[model samples]
Target: MRPNYLVIILLIFYSCNKIETRDEVYPTKLYEKAKYFQNENISDSAFYYFNLAKNDYVKINDSTGASKSLVNMAIIQCNNGDFYGSIETSLEADKLLRNESDSTVKSTLAANYNNMAISSSFLKNYEESVAYYKKTLQFSNDAENRYIYNNNIGDALILLGQYKEAKKYLELAIFTKDSLIYAKVLNNIARAKFLDDQNYNPLPELNKALIIRQNNKDIEGQNSSFSTLADYYLEKNAEKSLLYSYKLLETSEKIKKPEDQINALQRLIMLDKPNYLKYFKRLTAINDSTQTSRNKAKNQFAVIRYDVEQKDAENKNLKLRDAENEINIIYLSFGLGILIITLIIGHFWNEKRKKSIKIEKEKEKELEVKNTELRYSKKVHDKVANKVYHVMSELENTENMNKEVLLYKLDGIYQISRDISYDKNDVALEHNFSQHLSQMLKSYSSENIKVPIIGNEESLWEDVGDHSKVEVFYILQELMTNMKKHSKADKVLLDFSRENDLINIVYSDNGIGISEFSPKNGIQNTESRINSIGGTINFDTKTENGLKITLSFPAKN
Candidate 1:
């Protein structure tokens, strides 16, 4: 009993799947239905089904199926007088079949090229039509299609007024086994010859073509032959011309071709017939009706394309929205994970930063204590020790030392200590420090030495800070004192120039240059003062040339 129940359940599932499959319509079936409607001359129904088949094939990734449907729809559009629309559809089919290997697809591509040629001809683009017809011949392997395309090229060339060139393709088309196409080519060649030369007689060829079309029961071909014959006799034989025009009108009416009917009516009106007014009214009515139908067909095609595009856009938007939703969910999860990890790291980083700051504060306190001790030692050496040495030298010279000399030495000691304790210097920080520097250099100069100052411009020191100005004064004073005591300099050149944010001072003297001289107290003191004000000094001295010192420091604004 359990086995029986399982078998029934499986059968029910299979039945349901079969029903779902049967409900779906295949692209091939849709294409067949479109072809049937196209052959029945129901253009709207044909276009509707062809578009449906094209969309279905695209969904299934079947490019060949879609291309075939596009070609058929192009034919319908051309018949409805939508030449531009037909050309676009044919081009789309050609693109889809570019790399196709199937013989049927190749044949369809050739047919599509031919359709584009025909549509271009109707649009009066004769040159483009001829080019498209040549392309059709290149892709066509069938003799009949090749002959037909050659004839099409010939007709377009004749319309372009190339009578001599058109003869080649017309003669090629005349060799086809298809009697109807052969007859049409004969008529076109006759027209080309007639237009090429005024004395050319096309009556024989035109009459032969008309008889052949009649025998083959080719109604469209017969209509074309009659029209050509009418045009041929229009200027030569009025009676024959009237007769052919009437015959064309009768044939066009029988076939329900309004364009042909209108052309015949216009020819009849031009002939000054007895019932010209009646034919004129009929021509106007047929032209209006034809134009209305063409407009309706164009609008219908536009609406169908719009609807398809709207549906495709809606489907694409739905897919994009779904993808965005998934991306947002992923971002939310990732953001939460990053936030939790950042919080954990930040907690530990805060504790580590606190410990580092505490250690930095203890080191700063130790550095401050060491700096204070160094400052006190420098003060003692500069003040008390130097003053005590001066006192001992005075005591050693006891014969020359008196009460006045002792008082003078004590006063000098008091002045040295006072200078160390004070922050200000009366002479060094004076506004006339530049004058004092000039006088000091002049005092070192004598009859044997020359000191040439290049720049004594007051503006050079205008941007210099007070502390830097005092250092500069003392440095120059110390250099001059050394030159007088040791270096027997002949000439000195001092140049000062301010560039950008720096001051450059160059000092060169022609003196007996010391080769291995050690820096004494004056030189050491000059280096310390220069460094305190963020300045640099370079000394250049050779065996006998001279001493050239180059000094550069930042000019404080």
Candidate 2:
């Protein structure tokens, strides 16, 4: 009895193991069933089984198997006119097979690219389709796939109006040993030639392709050949065109491709047959049905993708919420510790901030006092010292004392001192600044010297601030004094212009320029005044060319 019980137990364990093994192999069986249905042209069943296989493979983490199913599903989706869905599925397969090394895996990768090319072509994305076909060529080591991809790329180029480029790839496909592929390439080349020039006859190549398709019993190829021949003969030979168009319609219906059937029916309608209205009605019906099916398929695909993305987002949100809860607990604990430390450090930081503020205020006060002293010194130097120096020079040069000239000089000095004391040195601001500036320039002119002023419109000085006006007046005075005393300039040009918010002044003189001179008191004073007004001055000097100075500043209103 014990021996019998052991045998029963061992049998039950073996049965359980066998069931587990069968479960493990189920995805491969599902993939095979999908392939069988796809070959039979039962697309609905094929899609159902392919999805099943894909989900099963994904459950087992079998990426290669899932990719294979996905590629096939993408092809079916493309045929059903779900081009956007097909593209997404093909990209998913491409990601899975990116690092695969097996020869079969490589073939699948090539097929994935080819499927993407076909889908893009149907969507009228000719350039992207051509790019995907080229990618297909890169992975396609087999001659069959290479020839097919070359032909597909060439056809897409022809559609894009690149007949010359299309001929090159078509010729490559023509080199294949497969007669069917060679015939297809020849037909495409002939069509490209005919389209490029209507005078070219494509009938010879069409006849050759037709013969090959008929011999091979390839219904789809026959349909394509008949359609091309019918279009080629439509204007030249109406009867022959009608016969081929009818043949194309028959073959298309036999192949059960609604798009092809509608195309053939439309061609027949264009032939002006006795039953033209009948063909037109049939064409309309088939076209409407085809469009409806495509729209339904696209909608279905979109719904499925939306649902998948939504579920994925929901799952991600759940995971993030769980992680956030755990992190919040840790952060709360850490925050309490950080808060205590921050309170301790903040007290010290507050004391340091107060000390820093006090030091900054002291520095600011010192800067203000120094600035006040500098302003007083500049006023005395410009107003008192300069006038005193001129008086002393006049006294030394004169042998007899001229009371009127001395009194006139003394009165000018007293007025200048009063202007400096009141900080109202800009006499030009009392009248038109441009006219005053012109009068000042004329003062620097003599029998041997010429001063040409240009672009000095009164409007240009309208935006000058009071302080900037005073500084500018002093700067010009210093420059003219330097030129009169040292430059020996015969001609001077002063141009002033306002652009946007900036005032530009160009001062140039033809003089016996200094070879290399340091800044004298006059030049130093000019620079200081310009700096006080926030203006820039640049000097261009050469012994032969004299000196040119450009000054610019932001116009202050």
Instruction: State TM-scores per candidate.
Output: 0.53, 0.49
Q: What does candidate 2's lDDT look like per residue over 1-557, in tens digits?
A: 33335445655675566568753548888889989999998876787678778877887888888999999989989988888889999998888896657887888898998999999998899999999999889888988778888999999999999998998899888888898888789889998899888898888888998899899998998988988898888889998988988898998899888877887888888886788999988988887888889888877655555565576578769856865675555446556665666678788889999999999999999999998887877777765765576576457656797899899989988888777657674565667777876876667676677888898887888768877876776677667656766787889888888756789888888887766757866677778888878889877765377788888887883
Question: What's the TM for model 1?
Answer: 0.53
| Superposed model 2: Cα runs more than 4 Å off | 1-26, 100-102, 299-557
User: For each predicted model, how many residue pairs clash, with residues at least 3 apart or on different chains?
Assistant: 0, 0
Query: Candidate 1 — what's its lDDT?
Result: 0.80
* Clashing residue pairs found in predicted model 1: none
The lDDT of each candidate is 0.80, 0.81
Model 2 clash pairs are none
Per-residue lDDT of candidate 1, residues 1-557 (tens digit): 33335445654575576557754549888888988998888988889889989988988888888999999889888999888889999989888896646788878888898899999998899999999999888778999888888898989999999998999999999999988898989999999899999799888888899899999888889899989988888988988888889999999999999978987999999895788999999999998999898878777887787687788789779866865665555446556665666678778878998999999999999999986675454454544554465456346535667888788878877776777656445355656656666765665566677888877677777778887886676677667656755678889888988865789988888777778657977677667768877889878755368788888888883
